[model samples]
Target: MSTHPLIGWAVVHPWPAAGIAAATLAVLGAALWVTVRTARAIAWPPGPVLVAGTGALVCTGFGADTSWRFARDGLGMTDTTERAVLFAAGEIALFACAVMARANKTATSTDDAAGTTGVPGILVWAITGALVVPCYATSGIVGGTIRAFFGPVCAALLWHLAMGLEIRVARPEALSTGLPAVVGRELRERLLSRFGLANRDRTAEQITRDRAVDRAVHLAAVLELHPDGALSGYRRRRLAAAVARSGAGTNGEQRHRLLQQLAARRTSGQLATVPLASPWAGTPVPDEAYPRTPLGVTGAQLRTMDPLAAVRLVRAAHPEDSPAEVAALCTGYGVPVSETQVRIALRAGNQVAAAPAAPRPVLASEPEPVLGAGLRLDVESTALVHPEVQSRVPVLAAAGTRTRQVHARVPADDQTEPQHTAVPDAAHPVPAVPEYAVPHNEDIPESDRDVPDPDPLIEQARTEYGTAVPSYRALKTRYGIGQARAQRIRDALGGTT
Candidate 1:
């Protein structure tokens, strides 16, 4: 008897089902191995990957069992084909998720901040879920309805956990509120520079010190905005030109020299602007100024020259000097410099003499030729004592007190007598006149230099008595001179009297 058509159909379906199972195992194993390798490489806080992998494997087994039941129950219907399709699609998505999780974790290790791995981890799970859920829907409307509700919930939880793991590996530290806000702007600038969309104003070392996420985002933005330098980027052409003019070989050397030149120009208001006769002036300076340049002097020739000459020649020879070369020159000279080490020594050889201090103001009453100290209290007294004297002079020290006697002579011959005196003439001398004819000169006229007027003072008092004479109370209280004039009165006195 001929075999039933149903028997043939059943036998062919199991083989395809078995083929899918084998393929699923192969794919899952490769994906699992990738995850394991990534986890091993980081030697991360170990348990999470193992748990996650075990859970995925368990989910895969459930999917396989479901596939078998659908194949057995649906037999030859279109639904049976759909079941196989869902099974294959779901396993593929799970495999993709596994691979993505490992990739994200590996990427996190490279990032400085682990928490920054959030976006990437979520992206992986999202893409896989988006693709995988449709597979269940294709199998049967009921299967689609069930997975639609639950798949998202499970994928979300897994995504979050994967992100947490990635964060721990990438951004071990927490960020402050202000840091996150600034990160976007920082990232934008970096992106523009990386892709040549914007001028790369900052150097490599400067970028290294910057945060990693900001740098990555900057790189990404640059690439996005100007994939082919199409945006007509910013040119730090001014800085580059300045560097060239500074005659410095490297960026660092150029910065140092430029700063020095700017400062010097500001102070002196002059710069070395050589006037060229033509557009292509040969090396700016004269031939004598640069003896070695035309000759193309080697290192040995440089050593043979005078040390100072060598330094000059070195500077003149190259259009620019690198910081390293400048430093090397400084080392050779046994001098140290923090910047611009090869700068020529500018100190003059001779010392300048100091000018004398100007003379101080002097008093009319004080004698000339007095030093400032000697006249401290006198002359226009040292300006130092003027205030003190005006306030009331300080009492003289005991050692400063001194007294002197002055004498006066009274002549015995007051009336005219036979006395004669010879008066000298400028150019000629006459014989002395006889005593009878000569005029009497009274004791050098009894010099009135220190003597007070007697009769004149008495007469002046009669005309201006109230103004001239002290009041009785003032005389008695202050000077102790009462109602009478005495020529010689004994008085007791203190220092400097």
Candidate 2:
């Protein structure tokens, strides 16, 4: 009934109806395959839907093919290409409608559970279907058959453009849901820096070596969060880092001073005071600001007091000062509070002067050395913990050297002339006086004393009575510390009147 197009084209002859139809269908199938490949993955949209939809479109295309055959053979309509093109275009339209319907059905079924949705599905269906419209219309317009194809092409184009319009209409709905995530992530990092959360993995030796980059990253995170600088977050982080560095060293005095300053602000409200030149001026102040609490005169007040009294005073003033800070502070002033002693003082409501722990006496585990007359001996070791040697060696060393005493009552003018008779005694044998027989104290075992405890009472009172009490409580609860500590606070005695 028709010649093959290839055979016709080879001889430079015009293609017959069947040849034209066959060539048109072959090209359309290849284009559809390419369109589907570009629009969605076989893995993503599921292979079955693409396959089923494609089969339907192809079947519809065959309807156009049969129609064209009828027009060319049964009715004497000779434009084979135009007939084939219209059939392909109509089938593509039907295919597009089927893809959209299938996609919509899938979307509705999975909407609640889908991690991401709607846009991807619609894009897949719309773009695939729309790509075919032009190819089909171009086929239909062949051999001057333009009028019959324009309507369907326009309708497909209109449907394809609707996806962009819908996105604009829906954008407002997503703004609220997305904003909190952006804001919260930024805020929490800044807050943590303000609180000075330390990394757990660092060793004292590592920090002493100044390999503190891990600590620095956290500080940077805080700065990023506090960009507007409305809060004192930056200062808090700096203070915390300084305190941490100070605690892990022999030169802890400076760190203790900083901590004391921090404590002073918390208790006496001295450091928290905003002088007339206040930066955070808009913040409300009380109508009658109380006068600063006096911490008493320095050395004179401390001299006659109970040993633990100073520790309590520091605790009462600076409840937030770390144990290291308090110990270092007391150590700076020659107060000798152990780290544990400082902690206990802080816990006892800053009332009982921290009790001094008695030094354990060293037992006489070794034999005493005998000293010959006129041959004084002394030995000293830097380690001071040996009980007998602790007091004995230092005393012997000091006693070995005599004070400026009258050397034999320095010959009172004439009376010393009789002393020359002593030269005769060497023959009488002042039996070999041993050359400074100083015995070394064997090395003492290293003391494994525990550092003193921190005061929980002042800390608890500060929580109950501090200026930002509610906020502090909220932080405690959030961090999983219970409200019982808050309830037991001495500062909360009168409750929030």
> Which candidate number would show the highest TM-score if scored against the true structure?
1
Pick out the ten consecutive residues of candidate 2 with the lowest summed lDDT. 443-452
What tens digits encode model 1's per-residue C-alpha lDDT throughout 1-497? Answer: 88888666657798876777799999999999999999778865546745654555555554455444544554433565676665445445555654565565455453443323334444555655564445363466777555544454344445445435544544556331224436986898789877544645766654432333233334434444466664423323333443444344556754564455445544453435754467575556543422333347655566565655555655565436654465464344433342333443322233346989989978678444433443322222122422211222254567353333222223445434655744534343333332322223321123322335242333433354443443333322443332222111111000010
Candidate 2 per-residue lDDT over residues 191-296, each given as its tens digit: 7556443454666664443333334434545555575675557656673675466543455654454445444443554545645666586867664222222475
Compared to the true structure, candidate 1 yields what TM-score?
0.23
Candidate 2 ranges with C-alpha deviation above 4 Å: 1-150, 162-413, 416-428, 431-497
Clashing pairs in 1: 113-170, 113-171, 114-167, 114-170, 114-171, 190-218, 191-218, 191-222, 363-380, 378-381
Q: What TM value does model 2 have?
A: 0.16
| Candidate 1: clashing residue pairs, number | 10
